[model samples]
Target: MVKSGQVSRQAGNNLASVMSRSVAKDVYTAIIEFVTNSYDADALIVKVQYNSIDDTLIIEDDGTGMDQEGIRNFYRIGDSEKIRNPFTAKGRRKIGKFGIGTTLLEYLAERYVMETWKDGKKITVREKFEGMGKGKGPEAVIEDDPGHISGTKITCRGTRFSKTGLDISALKKVLEWQVPCLPDFTVYVNRKPVSKRNLAASCIEYAFDEVIKDLGNVSGSIFYNKNDSEPLKATGIFIYVFGRSVGNPQGFYHLLPPSTVNRVVGMISADGLDDEISFDRGGFKQDSVKYHAVKKFISGVLESIIQDITYSKQKEPPRDKTDEIKEGIAIALKSAESELNKSLVNADGNINKNHPYRLELLLDEEIPWISRIDPKNNVIYINAYNPQLVVYSSKTNPTSALNVVFLTLAINALAEDQVGANNGNSDLFKRFAQTRMEVAKRLFSNFTPIGHYLKQQQGNDEQKAIAVSDVRLNPYRLYSIEDAAKLFGRDIDAVTRLYMAGTLRSCVKRRGIDRFRQEDILSCMSKIEGYIEIGSVSDILFPSDHESEGAAKHVLVNKIIDSRGNKPEYLKNVGSIAPLYFVKANNVEEFKRWYNGVE
Candidate 1:
């Protein structure tokens, strides 16, 4: 026989018991969710303070303060009212769904407190986990404080953090990497603002804005003119990384390659018509986002962008627009796929093979209307700029998307191959790596510069540079059957038959011949494309172990003769390429004679 209030207390205990378990997973995830909510609220300033020693965390945001009803709707568990409205003053679509982020703090800590205000009214909610549970301690307080500012302050006490100590460096790195775009926002640890190296400027901040303005497509503009004395205005893309604003993206184009470090192949942003790109778990799977919604959102922005691009090409007639539109569509699709893949991919480089996605052209309009790539993670980021979808890819090619997917797969496969390539190394794996790097380089070169820079900064500078170089090489450009046959010392029919039968090796033999063919033996011809191959010729020249003298005398001579000194700058810029080429070609004698100035 329990008293009436005791019976109610029993039910409350059960609810509190379950609530405790609810916040059990990753603590950082809770922090991320709260920060995301702040971003969605158009909060320009979000301060996060945490002390591992005390196991305490504090998050403050200068976003639109929530009143009593708003707090009730937002703070109350299982509330969906905020998401249902679907519109913020900042034009950010909602991402929060369960309204359980607040409880998560308490789950991680012994006590959680939230103080917020809206329309001059302030409210506070405090929860404690001691007695309200089955055998636990006491009750928590949820209040409304009139003196609170027009913002929200979340404080956690007695928090159980995973790490032994506060990893301020690692935390700063993560935050900087995660929110590279929102430079105006700041993150501080122990009252000290974390510093990050700014990476690159957004393309939208570059000529893209000018392009947009020139095209007169000002439907939902996000870029604003800055008073900075810089010649270029800020494009809508966010290129800052680790609390530092990225340098001009254009400067990186020639210096970095996509496959190197963390490459910024391009910048993209969604137009105002879609949900903001932020980490949230509503309307998406756990720890993931809805792929279709994202795609539709991106497609709408792309369609609008294509309109601007088309208008830029005013000299072109409508008769030729079909092919042009197809080209643009292909570019957009590839970029979209790449961006989505990279965003959802994990550090382990594993991809869910069974990713759900679909794309459809909007009424033969040459622009895809509905595009969706379902993510397994429930986190969706609500971005401030919903239009002008910015997409990054290996270049704007249909194959780039496939490459991104396959590249992740290959990374996993290679990791497995490393265990089994005990028979020395996997020839197939090497070829695959080479091919993938080549493709990645090409993509990075044409797509944008950030990816290349990222890769370089991550220490694979040489490899990434090669990849960027290959972008312009058009390695896919091969001679016609007839031309190839001639170069292989065979007839067209024989070459075609051999190629079809996959027996080209039998048809074309290279035994003890320094040159693959007579054309290969000839002096360098003056062709613009030759410059690309010449630039990449180093891979074929000099040995990895050759001394500088041996390299210069052997490789440099042949390149000069082969290139006919067509590009004099190569003499200074890539002298190594010249020397290496001659040495590897077994043209040492020819090189020596030329170098010695002998007839």
Candidate 2:
């Protein structure tokens, strides 16, 4: 048992304990709090200095300084005059609200000295904190000081610095992002002024009002680097609330593709968001409905801008010859697919069956081949720009065009057989070249008589001379070893070896280069059957191969009959309608016998 003694009751506030508890989480927050307070006082110039060697931080501002009464009001916790009156004496908007700016100083250092002058009188105050925790109130001392400047100066000793110490560059960036458009306001780090350059000259502004409900007015500008100069250090659309930035400049989470992002930078301001700003002022209150509404509106507008830029880029003319060629190939392939499918049939006279081909064609001007067959994909890539194809198309009729398609299909079929085997044989390409040449020779021989007949029908010397000269004197009518290699889709060295081995003949020599005429090439090809063994029926057929030579001829005769669908009597004289190479028939029963026979 103990008797209760008379206790002296004392009522006091633990200012240090309160201030320590109010410590900011980061150095940047602590620094910005003081700078913002300066802005509230209508500061025109704010200077910050960090001395790593002495572990000290100092901030000096030329603003309306505090008097004795103002100093007492500033030391009050959680109560600020700015909260009652949100504007300054000079009619400028105020940033400080809860009188926590002094508390934030505890986060930067253990001790702080503040001095100010007002109405021709100067006063100084010093406060020291033990540590950042619940403890005794901070030790404070107040005194008069001889000072002439009419502003505020704060020095924080025993300051805490990050692992990299002071980053002046980062501080400058923060200042720029915070007060980029502030008029008559400037900040300096280590005596170097921080300023933001106006991009108005290179940018297009979009002024929008109340794009989203309760989001207030929205305005921004999209800027482009005309010379493709170095990319902006901070890219993306920066978001501002009132006049202060809410976060680091963002690229809208990198939504746009690099093509548009690299050329563009932007800034957006949303009015009335200051009320919804986060406590730390780092960003908006994410859960707030107004914040989400603002974000959604901004995102949609940025997406539209990106689409416009992308569409404009696409509208520009082709960048190079390669691009033009690619476009041409795409158009030609689409047209060819539409036309070729109407008449295309398989060796068994079935339409698009058993061989199911898909074609992919690309034009590569550097490829040393008039056309190449990528049999793995059943693609027949052609060089329509080839000198021979250009000349031939100019003078030929529809039948000649059909013959060219037939030759391409024949080569593709033969190549597909070899590619499907996957045997990895080096001589397979040579076999393919031999098959191409053999089929081309047969088609040319069958087509030549028709050309001569057409020439005779002209019955004019001028027309005859032009035709003869084109066949004889035109350089496009013949091929050098390199050109022949291109036409046959073989290596130049292999084709040259064929020339040396007496398997090919040169029609003439122009400029010391051996050139083979179309007629001479066809003659040489006719003799190749004796030198190279034909392994597949495709090696003989012009457009497609059958199970046997008889089957191929049957399909050709049937195709001819189908072409004359309007004339049913054409089948009565089958021999007259048949090509010269096909077996003649005097009656339908005889034709059926040949068509039905096994290999």
Candidate 3:
């Protein structure tokens, strides 16, 4: 029969355990750890001094020092007494579990001296490790003093490095990196207060603060350096938890795109990550759930920072009329999709599933970048503040100038997919200038215009898509069939179907183009219509590399039928027209409910 009892380590085992964690290469870590111990002891000011002549390093703190019994407790290695109640008497947050700082003294020098005073009594200890002798445990010399100051002073002598002891400059840098900013506490080296570098203030930063569903808040600012200076090269995202650096800085780069990592630097601070700290306080326990949660949140914020950085590149506002020029480009881009799709899409037709459509006109003076393709989000970001574009905006049509830039970007989107598909080994872009020009010529010869969008606002109408107008009762301006789709946020396919089904009646029809009143387009868009394209729906729920379109559609269709007990409705000429299954849903959740077979 066995009974529960006090668990304990045999003599010298605890000391051996702590010494095993002490790294010989970095004696500075031990110094930082002891300084941290001082901070935990509610030290307001810690002073460090080193004598090059004697090779002696001393750290003294005005803190709640310990007596003879307390000195004995310090050797009780694994049993960190402060951890039982990890806060000071005045309620300062303590650096918990208290780092095993003293064991490192043995690695740094042959002799260690400690003097402390508490409760009107004093104790002095001169200690040595068996590792430097024929012993297996620590050997110590103890003495009792009548009185002393209320603080602890540690002295390390008998240098390990016989040649030119530690450099002050190098020591300061190491401590700055290892030690965190203690609240209301200061550390001094040779009477000079050592301060941390202000890496965030060195560059223009984008600040962000977000809470993950009221769980906890993470705040940070991301910095960008266009210069690629050597000083900034070593920088990336750094995370802090409880005033201590966590994980690794390089770990942040692994979570972002390759293009965004080079010039990015950030500092993130989060709370509630204490449980993840390792037994030795070397770093956080990477496999801990808290660490993963914090990382996942930071990953989302980094994506936004990337977008902001890209936009920040544009320094001039759009000299051209933004909406009109965008409308013209929108028309040109639609006409050029087939050419772009040859490269932008795969055979399975999975990527860019939502669209190779839509261009966002955010050409402000504060914005930068002539053209940027976000193929993942299916957006083409452009800075339309160009002289040529401004000149063309005055014309009844700006298709020429607009297509010159927009079509080129569309091709770049295609190249992105092609390059990605070929595993990045194609020499198609070797003679970049000639190849691009030739490709542009071939794609442009087949281009055609779709509609008009440059017009003043008109009277409001309650409903649209009600009936065909006589071009007279038109309170809304006329728009091309393509323009109607663009203005109302409907896809070209959606607008076309609504038109064919007589829900969107065009007032003017001439030469292959049908023009609709804005009122009618509005009504059509306002109609509660929902669609589920197999590839599109698959992209929605399972964004990453996921199930095949056919397999996904079968499951979705069965789910809808079984749950709603109603067969899905398909458009007439579904095979010839767009491959979409329709359902009646007034809201997004309702549409998702229909597709997912959820009530």
Query: Across residues 443-498, which tens digit of lDDT does each residue of candidate 1 receive?
Result: 55444322222122222112222121222211111123433333323323223333
Segments of candidate 2 deviating more than 4 angstroms: 1-25, 133-147, 200-212, 224-227, 258-264, 318-599
Q: RMSD in Å for candidate 1, one decimal? A: 24.4
Per-residue C-alpha lDDT of model 2 across residues 7-63, encoded as one tens digit per residue:
675524555455544446567667877888888888889999988888889999999
Sorted on lDDT, best first, the list reads 3, 2, 1
Q: In candidate 3, where is summed lDDT lowest over 10 consecutive residues?
A: 454-463
Using lDDT as the measure, the top candidate is: 3
lDDT values, one for every candidate = 0.41, 0.55, 0.56
Best-matching candidate per TM-score: 2
- What TM-score fits each model? 0.36, 0.48, 0.47
Q: Ranking by TM-score, best first?
A: 2, 3, 1
Q: What is the lDDT of residue 389 in candidate 2?
A: 30
> Which lDDT value does model 1 have at 153?
83
lDDT of 3 at 88: 87
Pairs clashing in candidate 2? 16-137, 16-138
The true-versus-predicted C-alpha distance at residue 262 of model 2, in Å, is 5.8
Off by over 4 Å in 3: 1-18, 21-25, 132-147, 161-167, 200-202, 208-215, 225-234, 255-264, 315-599
1 against 2, candidate with superior TM-score: 2
lDDT for model 2 comes to 0.55
